[model samples]
Target: MPNLRDHATLHFIVLIWGFTAILGKLITIPAVELVFYRTLIAAILLGFVLVQRRQPFRLSTGAGLKMLGTGMLISAHWILFFASANVSTVSVCLAGMATATLWTSILDPLINWRRIAPFEVFIGLVIIVGLYVVFRFEFDHAVGLVLALVSAMLAALFTVINGRLIKKHNHTVITFYEMAGACLGCILFFPFYVRYFFPKRGLVLVPDAAIDWVYIGILAMVCTVYAYTVAVKLMTKFSPFAINLTVNLEPVYGILLAFLIFGDAEKMTTGFYIGTLIILLAVLAYPYLNKYFEDTKNAWKDRRAEKRAEKQALEKQNTTNQDPALETIKVNR
Candidate 1:
């Protein structure tokens, strides 16, 4: 467990992450362009850090390519995330993003070729029910909600893949490459985006106001880079499970921050709140439930092993005594 200061630092990190959504909304640009700038800046900053540390930038061909590819998914997730806020209330967007836990629960099993625990399945269904309630009450924001949900799924996928990659590589190296890839993805996407989806003469590459630049810088440096660095450092003190459990508070922090920053624009209906509460409750409970089940499973395995050992020992003793008795009888005869 983390101490009080560690807990505070963890929550502060989460709060910074929550602010990213607010910054996205504050920036005046298309979601695609926003992602491009964010990725570019982050990649540049991370590269400088690596060079300063004298760390090698080179990686195996396959691993290098894999990290880069994962960047496109990251780009898509942020694009959808910002777009969600643009299309609807920040509260609604955060609510949709909250379902990321549900998506991860489902995706992790299939991706890792592991069985999905019964508890995970049950929690997923319950989350779906919460989503349905929100949908029924806030029908007007349906498209935004859908976009946010898809973004959550993408985020989950990226997380699962990144978990594997991190085991064999330095996180900053992987992230630097992924940031470059995200930038590349945006470059490739720009032509098609302006030609069809956005339907403009050219890309909206520049920020109109100075504050927009300020917001974008904070989004990249503070939220993306700083927060990640802190989390990695704290990993030595906190188990990954504990860290992730704390991370589940992201939506709660985001929603609160949205209300504070955006005021009336962020408020939603009573039903929406109820449904969101349900979803959050399930997400927050997941780590504890998973830990309990995992411990129970290990206990059962140990008990069975002990029983088998005792039975084998008893059988060997009975066999030894019977063999001596049979030998004595034969000798007497």
Candidate 2:
């Protein structure tokens, strides 16, 4: 069970994640510049914390490479996430990301070589239906919604990959590698982004106003570095499913924050709310359903093991009592 600190930290992480969208909206820089700066700051701040605490910064060369690769995916995820918010509303971007659990369900089997349970498929389908409802009627923001879904897919992939890396290394160490990778990815993409997306436009890298600095600080220091590390630590106590489900509430929190910050611009139609409720319902229900299925699977495995043990015991008794002639016949047979 989660303790008070666990609950408090989890909620705080969700709140920080919620503010991510708001910060993205408020920053004056473009998505590329914003993500580039965010990762750069987060990497530096987190590196300082790790060094101050005297944590190990070592990983195997192969593991370090994998972390860097995952970090690149994380960079892509954030870029898409912020771009979604820029083109559409925070609500749409967050709502689409809420489907990450569904994506994980589908991807886990392929990555881990496990049978994909029917229950997981069923739950995933239900979430898909909710997303369909949201996008069908709210088609004005379909492109942004799609981009957010792509972001969610990338998020799920790297998140699962990180779970493996965490078993062998500290989260801070892994995070440092990933942060470096993200910075490199943004640097590599900037030239292409400028050529294609902002052709003929002069470089606009720095924040224009002091207010932009505030948003950037919140995004980098609070949301990215601090919140991410805290959540990584909490995974020792809470299940990933539980953590992720709570993360779904970030959309709810973000939408509310959007309303408070942007007021009329954040308001939506009745259909949007209905779709949002359906998505939230699916997000909340998934953890319970997953736990139940896991329990059932373990129970069945225990029963099978018990039956096998009993059979082995009976066979041993029969063998010990065997007559010489019968033993010889059995051997010949």
Q: Which candidate number would show the highest lDDT if scored against the true structure?
A: 1
* TM-scores, one per candidate: 0.95, 0.91
Which runs in model 1 stand beyond 4 Å of their true positions?
Answer: 319-333
lDDT of 2 by residue, 1-333 (tens): 789988988988998899898889888788878888888998899899999999989878898899889989999999999999999998888888888888888888888888988878887877878887888778999998999999999999997898788788888888888998998899999888888888897457877888898888888999988888788779879987888678878888988899899998878777777887887887788888888889998999999999999999999988888777797999999
- lDDT of all predictions, in order shown? 0.92, 0.87
- The true-structure Cα RMSD of candidate 1 reads 1.8
Candidate no. 2 TM-score: 0.91
Residue pairs whose backbone atoms clash in candidate 1? none
- For residues 114-188, what per-residue lDDT tens digits would candidate 1 score against the true structure? 999999998999899999999999999999999999999999999999989988999999999999999999999
What's the count of clashing pairs in each model shown?
0, 0
